[model samples]
Target: MKVNIYYGGRGLIEDPTLYVINKIQDVLKEIRVNVGRYNLYEQKNGISMLPNTFKEADAVILAVSMEWYGVGGLMQTFLDSCWLYADKQRIKDIYMFPVVVATANGERKAVEDLRGAWELLGGRVCEGICTYVSNRIEFETNQVYASIIEKKAEEIYRIVSHKAPMLPNSINSCHVEIPSAGIELTPQESEQLSVYVADDSFVKKQKEDVEMLSQMYKSILGKKSQPDSEDDLLKKLEKAFNPKEASFKAVFSINLNDVNKTIVLDIDDGKLKSSYSSSAKADITVNAGKDVMSKITTGKTTFQGAFMSGLITAKGRLDLMRMFDRVFVFEY
Candidate 1:
C-alpha cells in the first residue's frame, strides 16, 4: 500500500515529534511496507500539488503536533494546502490518521486542537496515538520514548492491516508512561558519576566544540546515512571509550557525583583513536544498548533542552562531554 507521512511544526533538528515520525517509517520498512514522507516545511513555499502517485495511495497519514495548545502554524499552512489538492481531486477514500506528540501535561489540549483541525478539513480521524515525552526532563536516550513510538506504530499498522474503519467516537490511544522511581544516589555513588562543570568561563566554548565534532562526524558518515546502517561508526565510538585503546585517551575528568549514574555512547574510530581512555573513571558506561541514544547523537534531541533537563549529562571535561551531543541523525 502506498503511504505518505506528513510533518508539521517549527522545524528543529532536535524535536522529538519529528523523531517519532521517523521511527514510525523505520518500523513500517522493517515490516516491508512501502511508505513515503513529505516535509511540510520543505513544501511550504512550493506550488501545492499532491503528486498523481500520492493520489493513488491506499492511505495518507497526517502526522502533526499541537504546539502551545494550538495547531502549529506550519501544520496549519500544510493543512490549508491540502484543501487546494482535495479540491482538484476526489480523495475521500484515502484513510487518514492523526498522530499527536504531546507532553504528559498537555496531551488533552493537544488532542482537542488536532480534532478541531481534522474537523475543519472534513477529514476522518482514524486511530490517534498520543505520545508523551516528559517536558520536565530531558529524554536524551531513546529508552522509553523509542519503545513507545514503535509500539504505537505497530498498533497503527495492525489497524490498517485489518482494514479497520474509523469509529464514530473512538480515538484509539497509546502513550509512554514516565517511570515512577525518581533517580537518587548516595554521596559515594554520586562521587562515582562523571561531572563536567559548565561554568561561565567555557560553557559556550564547550557547546561550540561539541557542535563542530558532530559536524565532523556527519561529514565522515555522510549527512544522509541512516542510524541503523552506521555500525562502523558505533564500533569506533565503543573502542574509544575502552581504556586499553591506546590510540585514543579519555579527554575529561568525570566526577560521577555530578552527573547521571550511567553514560552510554557510540563513538567513531578516528574519534576513538584521538580520545580513548581506559581508566576513564566512569561509574557506569555502555555502548548502544538502546536505539534512542543513536538518535540523540544524530541531533534528534535539542542540545540545550536535553542537557538542561538532564537527558544528556557528562563527567570529566565539560568540552569532551559536549561531543556526544552532535553524533546521531534523525531520519523523519
Candidate 2:
C-alpha cells in the first residue's frame, strides 16, 4: 500500500506534529508500506501543483500543527488546491486520515475541518489522530505517546489495505445534494485556471486581451473611440491641490475603462502630476478602477471613503495614502 503524508507545519524543530508523524512513518515503514512525505512549507511556491501527487496514493495523511488558532494557511491552501485540481472520481476511492497536533486549543475543530474538506471533495475519511502537546520534551520522550502513534499508523494501514467501509456522513450528504454555482471544469483545466488566477501578470495580460477585443468590436460597430482626456484629468488634479505641512512623494496606480492602461499619479514638491506608466514604483500602491475613479472625479467620494467602502484597494505604506484626500480636495 502506498500512503502519502502531507505535513502542513512550518517544520519547526520542536513541532509536536512533526515528531508524531515521524514515529508514525517509522511504523508504516516497518509494515512495508510505501510512504511519501510532502512538507508544504518547502513546496509553498508550487502548492497548486501538489495535488497531482495524489494520483498514485491509496491513502493520505493530512497532518497539521495548530499553534495558536486553527490549522495554518498552508494547510488550508493545500486543501483548496485539492478541491480545484484533484480528480473527484479518484479522490472518492482514496482514504484520508487527519492528524492534528495542537499547541493551543481547537485540535478537534481543525481535524473536523480537514475531514469535512476531504469528504466534501468526495473522498473517504478514516479514523485519525488528534492530540495536544504543550511540552515537546515530555511528549516526544513519552513511550505511551510513541505507542499511540504506532498503533494509529497500524490502524490506518489496516483500513486502507482492507478497503474499510464507513457509514454515511450528514455533512457529505448535504454538500452533495445542495446546488452550488460553479462552472464545470476538468481537473487539469481547474489546475490551469487556479495557476493563472494566482499569477498577476497572466491575469493582467488576459484583461488587456479582453479590452483589446472589446475596442475592436466597438470600432467595427462604427463607434468612434473617445479622444484622450489625460490633460484634462491632470488639470483638474493640479487645481485640486491643497499642500500639507508635511512633504512626501506618493504614486497612484489608476485603472480606467476608457483607456486600456494604468495611469500613475505622482505627488511631490507640492505638485500633482499624472502619466501612463507600467513599471512605476510607489510608496503606496492604490488600485482605483473606473467606477471608483468616477466617484472621485464627481467629488461624490474621497479616497479614504472609497477605500473604506471596498471601492478602492490599496497596499503598502497605507498611512501615507490616508493623507491623499487631505492634500487633494476635489471640486464638485
Q: Which candidate leads in TM-score?
A: 2
**What's each prediction's clash count?**
26, 0
lDDT by residue (273-300, candidate 1, tens digit) is 2222344454223322233344444444
Candidate 2, which ten residues in sequence have the lowest lDDT sum? 219-228
How do the residues 1-332 of candidate 2 rate in per-residue lDDT, one tens digit apiece?
Answer: 67999999999998889998998887677546799999999999888788777767779999999998877999999998887666666687679999999999889999999988998998899889999988999989998777677668767866775566778888567656434457576676665654432334543564575566445434433533333366566566677878784466677766654466677778888777777775458766667665456556546667765654445655545455457777878875
| Model 2 CA RMSD to the hidden true structure, in angstroms | 21.1
In candidate 1, which residue ranges exceed 4 Å CA deviation?
A: 51-54, 87-90, 103-105, 119-122, 135-142, 168-332
| lDDT of every model, 2 decimals | 0.50, 0.74
Question: How big is the positional error of residue 61 in model 1, measured in Å on the Cα after superposition?
Answer: 3.0
lDDT, candidate 1, equals 0.50
Task: List TM-score per model, in order.
Answer: 0.45, 0.54
